[model samples]
Structure formats: C-alpha cells, structure tokens
Target chain A: MQIVTNNPLVREKLQDHYAVDYAEGSFGELLVRVRDKAHLGYRLLSHPLSGSVKPNETPYKSVLISDGPGALDVESLTIIENSILTADKFPVKYPQMSAKMRADFQLIDYTLLQSAL
Target chain B: MKLELGYIDIQDIQFSEESKIANGVLYVNKDEIQKIVLGQEHIRSVEIDIARPGESVRITPVKDVIEPRVKVEGPGGIFPGVISKVGTVGSGKTHVLRGSAVVTTGQIVGFQEGIIDMAGPGADYTPFSKLNNLVLKMEPEEGLAQHEHEHALRMAGLKVATYLGELARNVQPDETQEFETYSIPEGMEKLKGLPRVAYVLMLQSQGLMHDTYVYGVDAKRSLPTIINPTEIMDGAILSGNCVSACDKNTTYHHLNNPVVMDLFDKHGKEINFVGVIITNENVYLADKERSSDWTAKLAEWLGLDGVIISQEGFGNPDTDLIMNCKKIESKNIPTVIITDEYAGRDGSSQSLADADALATAVVTGGNANELITLPKLDKVIGDVSYVERIAGGFNGNLKEDGSIVVELQAITGATNEMGFNRLSAR
Candidate 1:
C-alpha cells in the first residue's frame, strides 16, 4: 500500500533498479534484517520512529536481536511493506521474459513510469 | 474583263483537299467567234489553259469581252488542256475527264499547280467536278500546295484530338465531352495598340469558352509551327493560336527554375491551366525510379496532375515486397505497371505469388502505360472484378526506360480519396 522507497535520492535513480534479495518466511524476519542493516535503514520509507504498536497478525512479534524498546525503526517498516508486496516484482529477471512481457511489466511498475499522467 | 493585274509571288502553299493529290483529263471547250470585213479579217476570243489532255473548261463571259486574262498558281504552272479532238491524243475523252475532272466518291480533291489553270474562257469554264462532287468527294481547299505551317498545325490538331478521344473513352463519363473551338475575334480596334492587353483578353475569352477547356499551342506568335485545338471541351477540334500541337514532347515538356504557375500568373489571362504534362524523354527519365521512389521524384520533376510509375521486372521474390511497399507508398500519386504476369490464382505462379502479383497489378495497373501481357486473367482475378477493371483501364505503352507516364484522370474520379476498396476487392 505504501511506497518502499521514499528516500530523496531514489527519485534521481528512478530508471535504475534496486535489489533487496531476501528469503522471508514471514514479515517479522524481513523486518529484523532491515532493522540491523544500516544500508536499508538509510533508504527506508517511514514517518519518524515511534514505539506504538497496532494490533495485527503478530502483536508481540519479538525482536530477535533482543532490543526490547523502540525495536521497530524506519528500516523495519520498509522491509515490512516490501515483504507484503514481494510477489509483485517490478524488475523481473530479464532473460525469463519476452519483449512484450517486459513491456507489460514496465507498464505496471510505477517507478518505470515517465509520468503518472 | 478580268485581266491579270500582275503575278503574285507565292508566299506559301496550302492543300484545298483533306488529302492532296489530283488526277484527270482535258479538252478545248471554248467557243470561237470570228468576224470578217471587206477582204478577209478575223477577231475571236483566244486563250490558253492547262488541264488533263482530253478535258477542257468552257468559256463564259463574266463580262462581254474578246478574251479574259487569267493567272495560275500552285506548286507548278498549269499543264495544257486537249486542243485537237482527232487523234490518239484524244482517244479516250471519258478517261481523260475521269482522270482530270472527276473525283471518285469518298475521294478528296488535290490540285497540282502544274496540271490545271483557270484563264480566259478556261477560267470561267473550268469544271472542278471534284470540288462540287460531295457524294463522291469532299470540297477541295483553295489551292494544291502544302505549307509547312499548315501541315504542322493540322498534325498537331489531329494528334491532340486523337489523344483526347482516347482519354474520354477510357474515363467513360455519363456524358461525353467535346473539344470546344477557340478563335480570336477579328481585330479588337480598341486594343489594337495594346498588344499585351489584347493577348490577355483573348486568352480569358478562350478559357471562358467552356466550363473546363484544355488548349495547347506552339510557342510561336504569328506563323505557328504546330497547333492543336485550343479548347478540348467540344469535339477536340483545332482552334485558337496553337504553336506546339505536334511538336511532341517539348510542347508539353516542363522545366525547372521558374515554376509553370509563375508563367501562368503572368500570362493567366492568356494561359489558363490547372496542371501540365511534361512529355520530353530526358525530362521523363530524370523523374523515373522504381514505382515508390519515382512518384515523389516526378511530382517535383514535372508540375503535374499526377505522376505515374511503371515498375518493370516485378513478380520476383527479392523485389516483390519492395515493389509492393513502393506501390502502397505511391497510393496518392497515380501509377501504372507494365508486366507480363497476371498475378491470379489459376495463373502459372503459386497463390502467394499470385497474391503479391495481384497487389502490385491492382496498384499499378489501372490508368497506366502498360506493356504487360497477361495470360488467364479471368481464372485468376475472377470475371469483371476490380483487378479486371484495372486491367481493362491499362492501355498505355511502356517507355524505353521501362517506366509508364499516364494521365491521372485516366485512373480515377477526381476526389482525394484513394481507390483502395475498389482496387483491393476481388
């Protein structure tokens, strides 16, 4: 629902592809990797950090790295959003698709758009 | 008494008959009046004339006089009419008359200046049976000499008439068009001093002769070298001051630099035209290319109603698609194809070849200068189909450089819309 890359720099790299290769069984593991990863933190899409938790599928999802308070940082939220929309691969492996398919995928990817209008 | 004032040096010779040859006989047909007083004296009307050996002109007095003076004019001076009625010279008077005086039916009277004269009683009595005999012959023109100017004009008119007729027949309008005759009114006394103004007015008057009038002229002013009908909306008759009717290519040849429109604007009153056709060989070849490349080149080369491209050596694989593409590209410009292939299903070639062939033929065939010989067209394109319509319309000859130049009006009705549906259908 939310854009993964709200970073100011991402706009300049609009036509460039970004890879966040990960094996995530659930959304929590993906969030842990993002929180610990400084690179992902710098590029995360989120509002200022807060401790409030809303009821969801996993309310008490324990932080694996053992950080008790303020465990959810900016990076974790991006990983969370990325995990939910992982099925939608904007940049599919090139050789696997035909010219027509590539064009169709490009059409769907908003980042690939020259203009929203 | 009509006496010879003096001899007139022939300026030019013109044929009196549509055709220009005369043959016949002669005789002495003048009455001789003799008078004697006292001893012995004689006064009679005596004169000499030339005609066929056995035939002669009878004497008639325009006024009462002893003898009348006469002058003979033509290519040669007059020949002698028969004087002695008794001898082998006058054996067959009927044959001589038939040969000299009588013009057979459907024949034209052609006079030889050296063979006949109308002088004295002979001038009054001359019996030109050929001139008077309409059932057997047409009326003879005044004299029996052919002038180069007259020949050129006649030739030009005939050619233009013939071409216009063929074009009208091909277009097949609801009603036929006739070439209108254009003539400059006798001496505009007001414009006598104003040559330019007079010329302009004459042109406008000529153009106004019909709703659509086509005229051509040799580029000359006074004694025209060639001429054709000035207006072609009547019956293709020759009219106006045409100087280029039979000059062939140059008469219709277009040149670059100053455009023909400029020429027309300056002389619009004298020269009203919608478009022009350039018929010179070099000018034509300079504009030719394969069907596609040629039309544009030609439109620029010759300011024309439309450019026709003739693609030869088609019906081959390597060139088929290219020729097809060219034909399609030239959709707006009228084009022609001169080929030997029919491009039909039952033709010797396969269906794919047939299809390609049909496409090329349809796009290039109608209103073209076609030299292509088609075989089994009926089995291939079907009877009376669009292809057949195009094939039927193809009647032009191939140029030496392997292109065809045909009139745009020859192909389609005058609307911007292309004949795709008409040409593409079965």
Candidate 2:
C-alpha cells in the first residue's frame, strides 16, 4: 500500500517501509493528491476522512491507497471526491500552534495512519 | 439476560469532610477524590469543582462525562473490564446516581473536545447542563504522549465515577427500572407475532484519540458481534474517543442510551427487541467491509425484521452507516438510521459524506454546522483559550467580551446522533 500524507511524522516513519507520497501542503491538499492518484486507478485502502477530527481543524492527515494502478474503482473515486467536497464545506482555519501542539497533531495523524496499516 | 437499574436521585453535590449520599445530596471529600485521580503517574495535578443545573457556569474542552453507577448485586462491578474484573455484568441489580455526572476536562488532548454551558442559550443544547456535574480539571505531566494522556484522563473519569458510585451502594433508590432481553429461541417463542428488531451501535474507533472500549477490549480490533442490550446499561461500552464533542457518545450516553431505552420502551408491545449488534468505525476499508458483512449476517441470523442503527461520530462513519444500512436492507431487513448532520452553516450542503438510496428512513439530530452565539457566563470551569481551536470554532470565533460565536458542533451533545438531544428537523 501507498501512504499519502502532509504530516512529516507519517512520512518519516513510513517512507522506509511503504511508498510514502509526501504532500507539502495543507490537509486538504494531501487529500487532493490522493484523489488525483485515485483518478489514476489507485484504489483507496482507507477512508479519506478517517478520523472524526474535522478537515479544517487539524493541519495533518495521512491516507492509505493502493500502490499501483488498476481498473478505475468508482467507489474510490466517489469517496475521495465526496471527501474533498465535505472538507471544503468546513472553511480551512489552520490555527497557529506551539511546537509541542504541532508535534501532538503530527503524532495523532501518524497514529491514525498506523491504525489503517 | 435481565438487569435492574435503581436510580438514586441526587439533587446537589457539595464538598465535605466525608463522602456519602444522603437525602438526595451527595457530599464529597475532596482530598480522597484527588488521591484517586493523582494515583496515575502521568497526571501531575487535578482540581475538583461542581456545576449545578441552571448555574451560570461553562466547561470547555471537555473530555468525557460518566454517570456514577454501582453494580449492587451483579456478577461484576461497573465499567466491567476497565475498572472492575472482567465478568458478566448485565444480569443483576445496579445502582445509579441519577442526577449526578463526572465531567472530565483539562489541557486539550485533541482539537475535538467540546463545551458544556450550565445555563444559557447553549444550556438548552447540551443534556449535560441539566445534570449535577462534578467537573475534574486534570493537568498531565510536562510532556506526556497524546495516547497516554488520553488513557490517563479516561481512567481518571471512570475511576472517579466508580468511587462516587460506591456511596450509593446501600442507599434506597427513589425508583427502579428493569431491562431484559431473551435468547433468540425464547424471543421467537414469547413474541410470536411481533416484528423482531435490533440496535446496531457504531462505535468511534478510528485511531489513537478516537476509540471505544467494550469490556476493556478496544472495539476496533474486534468484529461486529451480538451483545445483550442490558449489558450496555451496566457500562459494557465506554467512550475513549476525542472525536468532535457534538456527536461522540460519552460514557454517560452509552450507559443510558436512548435508542436502547426507547427500544425497550416498546419491547414486546410494538416489536421483539432482539439484541444489540456492536460494530466499529475503523479507518481501513477492509475492516469496514468485514464488520458490515458480519453485521448483516448477524441481523439475518437473528431473524430481525427491522433495525435501528445509531452512528457515533460523523464523516468516515457515515460510510459505515450507509454500508450497514444497504447490506442489511439488501437482506430484506428494514433499517432506520439515527445521525446528526454537518450541512454547512447555511444548512445547504449534503447531510452526510456517503449516501445510498436504500437509506430512506432516517432520524436526524439536527445540523451541527448551524451557528449560535453563547453569551459569556459568570464562571468558567475549564480554560476557554481553546475555544477558537476546537472542532467547530473558527479563527476569531471567541469574541473579546467572552461571548463565543460557534457552530452547534462546539457544544457538547448539541447534535448527538443517538437521539439524546431535542434538536431535530421534520
């Protein structure tokens, strides 16, 4: 499986073990990258909106997807597209945080991805 | 299985030299309670406070709310595997501190913790406001990990609640209610002509801060299985979720689940209340598929003619809700899903992330995105600095005058998916 993440912790911990696609942007951007991959027939192995933490709240996210291209999975495309729409519904408001809080968010994101793995 | 819940109505709570329940008043010894909370090394300090109904108090970044309950004559203690030894607990009598609750709050572990206003327009939104809340403000050690921090707070809440529940052990209850569910064969024989119904409870188990425990076992690691509905009354399910406050089922909600209660209200009369099917909302697609498959199989195997599925948190779980609905409906078993919506601020966006035409019968717990202004209260029990960062709060959401403008999502139990709140649309 391939991991798409914007959190540095997720990339750092999983790069050696999996195909980690690191997105250097916001949480929504990471989902967009995963959506783009879904468009290329990479089936989503995890729900894009995995955690209940809203899209605009936490700044980090990590989603798992298939490592290679295959037949276009309509369900994957639909879920990713719907996830993007849902994420957009909540206006992005990435609040500034201390380094410790940032690390906490990163760790939470990494932990969520690990649950799927 | 049969269980009896004896409720000791608590009118108020006060700090005293000794802890006891008498004349509908709960007197607590603060030092003893502090000792229980500080027993864990991860926690550095804890402050105990009380917030009564109709008081001008606000508690924010709240973690979990647990009702104090003691298994008076049961095989096991309250909070089964977590606080007490693992055993069958739903078969006997349990005592409940009816009007009192233990509310846990502290340094925000995640951005999804919620707000509970004792009295205000916001008070009308949360059920916790109506309870005599014993608030615990706990601060963790300097740099505890997020997982450990959550575990510490969860344990503290359960521990304190259990400790307080002990006070009501020998007291006479004001009222007693009994709940029972029969085995599959017995149910079929007893309620010969009635429709068989079951409750599908979707637990929050997405990740570290978002999880639920069943008999002290993490629900995400288990498959969908059948459970005695009465077991829930004895604290079989506990919330370890840091999901958004508006919808996450707190331990209090689990103990007094409206769906279970309402189903029992009509049991044997309108339908045969079969049992509860516990499932988890995991992040992995395969797990979701497997759980939903098992759920459908169990429902068909139980000969359920109808089911009421209650979802915990939103977003990803919506997919599980729909999958369960569709798969179960595919078996010719009708389903009624209970959930809250995030239909945007204007209430124009789609209600759920995933949808299927088969999910036609639904019960909505209002819209979480609908915004409201909470007037500043006189006393704030927990820190309000985390307001702007909480799930439903945006930048500049907390005003200078202490009043906060936020979506209903910020209020605890505002849009509870369990039909626990009064918010709903026709």
Candidate 3:
C-alpha cells in the first residue's frame, strides 16, 4: 500500500486515504499540467510521478519542474521506495545583504499529486 | 605526466581599528584550504600572519577596508593577493610612507583593500618586468646650474623608471596567451582585469613632499589616466608634483630657470650622469666664439629647467657685470658665473658675448659628456641636427681629433641598461 505513493510528502498527505484506496482497486494516472508563458511563446507539458505505481494501479507524486523566469534549475525524479524520503535537502545559507535586496529571494513553485487507486 | 594545476586563494579581510561586524564570504580554493571548511561552516573570522605553501589559503571577515588586489611584475606573470587601507581626508596618507624622506629607490606597501601603494624617488610601477630605457621630465625652478643638475638627474630618473616598468613584462603567466589588463584573484571568474601601477611627477612651491597624482592603467591595452590620489587635489591629472614651464628646448641661461632644480632632484643619485659646464668666455674674443656658440645651442636643445647668471664675484663685488642674472634667479634654479676671465676657442662664443653687454651670464638645462667642437662649416662631417637620423641609417663619423664623438641621439643598441640597473639593486 505504501508503494502506491512515492513521494514522502505526498505519502504523508495520503495517510488518511490509505485504507480506502488500497481496498477499492480502481486506478488513474497522476497527471500534473504546467502552464508557462515567461518566454516569447507559451508551452505545456505533463509531469509524471516519480517511479511506477503497481500493475493497473496509479502512483502518487509531487514535482517542482519550474522556477523564476529564465531559471536554469530543473529536475525529474523516479520513485524507488514509497515511504522513503528521496529528495536530498541541502541547507541554503545566505550571506548578509542590504534589506532591499533580500526581498528578491522567494520560493516560486511546487506540486502534490495522488492518483485514485 | 600530468600538469599540476597551481592554486592561489585570496582572503577578503579588513584591518579597521574602528569596527567588528565584518561581512562577506572569504573566497578560498577548496582543495588547498580544507582547514577553512573543516566544520562544514563558512569561515567567519580568523587572524592569519602569513600563509604556508600548499596550505596557503586564508579566510577573514570582510569589513569596510579595501580588499586585496593584484600586481604584475616583468615577464613573471601575475602576482596576486595584496590589500591596503584607504584613508579619509586628513587621515594621513603621507604617514604610511616607510623609510626616510630621502628615498633612493622605490618601495611597495601592502594595505587592507586589494590596493598596493608604491612610493619612492621617481617610482615607475608598470606591468612589463624588464625595462630597458626611459624618458623623464623635470620640474621648473630658478637658476642655471640647478638646471644642468636637472639634466643630469633626469638621466638618473630614466634609469630608475625603466626597472619597475619591466617587472610586469618579465613575469607574465605562461598560460596567458597575450597581455592581460585585470587583476587575477583566485576563485574569481577569469575576465579582463585592471592593472595597477604608480607613477610619480613633481610640482614645486606647495613644498617638496606635497601631494602628487597617480594613474592606474590596463598596461596590456590602453594608456593611463593620471588621477590625484588625495583629498587635496581630488582625482585631477594636472595636480601636484607637476607644473607648467618653458617649452621643449631653449637654453634659458639665467639665474632663475624653472626646469633646472627639479630635474636634479629627480635623477642626481643613480647612474653615471655626467655634467656639462658652459662658460661665457668671449663677449668679443675672436678665438673663443666657436666653442661658446655650440655650447649655448646644445644647452638650448636640452632645455634644462634651471640656469643661473651672476652680476658679481664671490662677495657682492660687482652689480652691473652679470647679464639677465635676476631673471634666472627668480626662477629658483641653480647658477654659477665665471666673471674673472674671458676667452673663446670657437666662433659660437662671439654670438653669446654679443647677446648682452653684461660681463657674465649663467644658464641651465640638459647636459652631455663628450664636449662637441663643431668644426668650421668646411670641417663639419654632417649637420649636427641630422645626428638623430644618422644614428640609425649610417655609421657615425670619426672626428678629426680621433675621438669617436658618438652621435648621442643616434647611438643604437644603447640598451636601456640603466633601466635594469635601477631594479637590480632593489
């Protein structure tokens, strides 16, 4: 049942529905649609969840695929263990700067996805 | 065989007597400076006396002081990592000067920021390491003898300036394909950088040690911009240690010529600077006219800032004897006069003796060693003015007197040996 949800944060959010989703056996693909229009043109793409769900069963996933405009930071993940935390959390230490420049630093986007199993 | 990549780390540190909360991450090479990251923490503060080889990385809190900068020596490539302190108005930039006020050679001072200060007698801090020759201009003052000394001293300064100039060219990095204009601190992204140099010129009147201007250049690319580095003059180019005086060449044989004394102050110490003495021996003598005229013309061409003419002998003896003595004296150059006797061995003296009715005249400006005796228009081998062209195109002439009067301007391969000589001792 734990393998149904791949992301740690997504699994933690799905703890209440685990018993019900496991018995039903109904399944759907977890789909994340992104709308980006920063550049001259608009484009769209589907972000699949990390790792496989089960045979005929959908997997749960959350992916951060976009950042600030003209951003270079991008990554895709494949789930290995459902209950395990797969994302490495490196500390972000910032140096001192004037108060005005501090406002420019902000988290842009993230997502949480769960399929009906 | 594998090429070992050499590493250098520049610590962004400040030494301010007034503050504590230092800011900025001290950039260091991770491979060489493992001690800085031992705790997985960014280095906050530490005092370092000096860095050892391989373990040469240092980290300190960055404050308001100027950061360490880079300097290029001759042919040796770039010598990076130097810091200096900047002073506010009246905070005493002159106080940082090391050694005696009478410096014989140039000296470098490392301060807090990435700035290096160079001070000394006519110091020239250029990128090229191996300097071979130099040209120097002296300040103006009163008196003719002072002017002659100025000429001799200028020769001295030319030698000194050459040494520092060549250091940059000599020590360039092997990896560098062409000359670079910027300072290369470790870890910083390699881009075009700025070259640091210190140039000295003099202006009399506000005192000998008054402030002067310095120009920082890219050395690899453009010429320099002379900026006053003090509050007194701001960043103006035509400030202290420089002044306006007479034109390029004219033997102003008076007691108060401006170009005379300043030149002496510039180059009197180093090198074998020879002095040439000119005397007014013939106001009307037929025999001495030739030598006097040649000497006068030579002086005019050299254009020394100092010249002195006297109207009297040792102890206020005669008032009306000296011609244009006061004019030269007012200029504050050096002066001397031979009022006792009059004689001439050349036709040039006739023109000088007839310049004024005074018994004596003294003037100052450039000096040369080999006394030139311009033969009669028939005895002459070539036009003296053409000496410059003759030097490169044709072999010099053999004077009738058997002495090889080398055309001074034309002598080739005279390798600015004087340039290297100044740096050799330092």
Candidate 4:
C-alpha cells in the first residue's frame, strides 16, 4: 500500500513506513512507502490518523490506490504500478511555505481508490 | 576532481586611503584599478563608482558583471586562457567576495547591453541589484572598432575582478561549499542503478561581437566536447556574448551557474550527474549541424539517460537550441531545455526561432518582448542619455519625466535562460 499525502505533519507522522525527504536528501513528501503494512495497521489503530487530507483546491492532487492484504497477480500489479506512475500529482518535493500562505498551498480535490480485485 | 569555494561575505564597499577588507567592508584603491584598465591601448578613460544595495541609482548600457574570485591553491589563476596562461585549473581552494561584483558599463557595444537598477520595482528582476557593485564607467578611444572596444572592456572586467579577488588570499572564508566529480569508471560504479544525466551548456558564439571563450580558445571554433563540471566552478567558461541584455549569460552568471548548482544538489541521489557538454550557437547552418551532431554523439557515447540543456541569448540561437534537443532526443535520451520567449508584447507570437514536438519539457525564463516602464531614479550611474538606441528601446523611449519605457529585453539578466529568476509567464 502506498500512501500519498500533502500534509507535512501527516507525512512526518508516517515516517517509519516511508523515507522522509530530509533523511533522503529530497524535498518531496508525496510518496510514503509501507515496508511493514502490519506496522502501518498498528500505527493507524493507535494514532489519530488524519481521515482525509483532502484540500478544497490546489495546483496538484493525487489518486491513492489501497489494496487490503493478499499478494496481487503479476499482470494486475504491472497495470496498477503503471497507473500510479502515470496520471499522478506534481512530481516535486514539498516546498517550505509559511502559515500565512494558506490559500496558496490548499489542495482542492482528491480521489482515494480501494481495490478488491 | 574536487574544489572548495571559500566565500567571504562583503556587506559594504568604500574607497579609501588603502585597499583591504576590514570587518566585512571592502576598501578599494581606485588608482590601482584605473591603471590596470588604462593599460589597454584602445580604452581612453576609466571612471570608477560604487552602487550599494537599496540605493536610488541605475546603471545602464552595462556589458558584464563578474564576481571577483582568487584561486589561492589551484592549478591555474582565475580567468585562465585569456587573462592568465591557458593552464588546466579546477582543483584546490578558491576565495570569493560573496556579496560583491564588478560591473562593466559604458557606451553601448551591441544593441544588447543591460541596465541594473539599484532600487525600485525593476531591481526585483535582475540579480545584480543585490550585490555591492563596483561600476567601471569606461570610455573608448575615438573611432575604436566595436570588436576592439568589447575586448578591452571584457579584459578590464576580468583584470579588475582578479585584482579584487587577490585581497581575500589570506582572509578566512565565512563558509565553504565543496564540489567534486568522479572519473567515468568510478562514477558509473557509484551510480549503478541511477539514471545517467548530463548538462548540455550551449554558449552564444555567433561573433558579430557575440562569443564565449573556453580555456583561452574561442568556443565558435570548437566541436561539442565534454568538460568536468568541477572545472566550471574554477572559471573555465567566460562569457564574451553581446546578445540582448535580457538573456545573455554575463561573466557573473557563468561563475554562479544555477543549473550546475541545482544539478550538483542531487548529483549522487536522484540521478547520476555525469558531466557537462559545452557547445556553441553558431550562425551558419553547416556549423549548427556539425555542433548538434557532435553534442548528440557525445551524449549517446556517454550512455546518458537524460540531459538538461540550457541556452544563451535568443533569436538565431533558438535554432541551435532546437537542433541540440531534436538530435539528442533522437538518440533516445530525454531532454529538458531552458529558454526564454519573444512571445511579442501581447504574448501571441512564436516563442522560438525553431520548434519541435520533441521539446516538450521546456522551462521558460519569461517573455523578453513584454514591455515595462522604469521610474526615473535620483542617480543615474552610467549614462542612460542614449537609452533609445538599444535593442528593445524605440526612438522616444526616454520621456520628459526622465522615466523610460522599453521592452523587458532592455534590462540585464531580466529573463536569464538558466532559470535564474522567479519571473515566468502563464
């Protein structure tokens, strides 16, 4: 499962499951990896997991694809990877913005996909 | 190769009884620099002045801006090949005056020299406005050829910068930034799974006074060749370009290249930043074809997966930009080109002299033809008396109110092609 987020705090909170940009020498906080999905489950259960960081408007948005457990077939995996790589959000690192620049960094729309195939 | 840049921040500049840096202030010995400049046969007179940041002053018909740097422990002196012997330089430590620059200004050399505003809205567009500028107001001898005058001014700027840089030889730098590039084998091994990348730096060398010098040799006479990215940090490339003011890469820009710096920021992680390919934008079609062919061959030979190509000047050079991109992309190497537009005053005209569908990822510096009015300043540093004759200025450009209206192209570094500014179009 890949978690896509725009919130720096939410992104930072999900650190162990992902490579936080500052640690990776990158500015992006977009793609959060899940090495141990069970760890992700534990964190989600105990922490105040932000339900939907869906902003009202933004220059960018992401399509999150979440699959519940089980390994996927090869063909289905390739298609999903391609879909995730293409038709995506802005491919840049998170910019350091101030609190006063709220309207500038607002995310307008989002789509979350839960797959059962 | 490895290089260390020692930056000594100069917060202020003044002329005094002696030349030295004391407590972040630089005291220049004017007579010494004047003698060096007048050493040239064609230059009749040289006047020096200082334009500090936030001052209500404007410097016009500017030729080049150079950051004074001294190589304290390098293979060769700064500005090698031209001012110094053509020695292989790019390792060891070099000292720089971080917040200062040498600006050459005088009578117009081409329709393209620039204007530097010390204050007001126009100051926001050009980077030179921030530095403590040491302005060289030079006057050429009567009937001196434009080519000779340009050469004299170019040499003067280099020599002056070199002289100032010498002051920091023993002073300790406030900060140090190190840059290095491994050999081919080592680099390949280190970048095993990373995407291979290179920077294709296109220099303007159409020579109606437009040119760039490489290691003392003229760039227009060279084939597309590979240069160590580290070498540039030590002043391997020199700008002799006389293109329009907006996009020409001044000597200062060459020293502080943003593309090279940005690429270096991610050199080891995001991509295997290989090296740089220095090519020229020649006026002839045969030369253009040959240079582009060689550039693509070098990129392919290096096994590059992607490349960032930055351009200098506009108009005729746009063809060179397209040819370089099309040929390199033809080799199956993805490319991103950096350029500015001449999209007309209304932003409806063609942006480049040539175009292709393959050039999809273009980072525009902005529209050079867009018009802007600069308010009159309390002090005119270099002589804006002849503003109407420059490239983007018309007959009645300077008005009765002393304020002048001209295309964005009239301002120096207003739309630098290296993505140097935050200005962009919708």
Cα TM-score per model: 0.17, 0.98, 0.17, 0.77
Q: Show the lowest summed lDDT stretch of 10 residues, model 4 chain B.
A: B105-114
lDDT of 4 by residue, B1-426 (tens): 888999999999999878898888989999988998999778999989999999999998888899999999968988888877888878999999999999998663323347899898889888899999999989999977666788888899899998899999999999999888888898889778888899999998755346789987788778889998777776789987655688989888888889889988998888888999999876444567789999999999999999999998765567678889999999999999999987767777667656789998999999877888899999987778656655566667789998989778888999999887546642
| Per-model fnat list | 0.00, 0.73, 0.00, 0.00
Return the lDDT, model 1, position B144: 25
Candidate 1 chain B, poorest ten consecutive residues by summed lDDT: B201-210
Best by DockQ: 2
CAPRI-style grade of the A/B interface in model 1: incorrect
The residue pairs in collision within model 2 are: none
Off by over 4 Å in 4: A1-117, B108-112
Interface RMSD, per-candidate values to 1 decimal:
36.8, 1.2, 46.2, 25.5
In terms of docking quality, model 3 is: incorrect
How would you encode candidate 1's per-residue C-alpha lDDT over B200-234 as one tens digit per residue? 10010011000111233211111111111221111
Error of 4 at B381 (Å): 1.8
Better of 2 and 4 by TM-score: 2
lDDT of each: 0.21, 0.91, 0.20, 0.72
Summarize candidate 2's per-residue lDDT along A1-117 as a digit string, tens digits.
Answer: 888889999888889999988868987788889988999999999999988888888788888989899999999999999999999898878657767668778877888888988
Badly placed stretches (over 4 Å) of model 3 are: A1-117, B1-348, B351-354, B359-426
Top TM-score prediction, candidate number: 2
Better of 1 and 3 by lDDT: 1
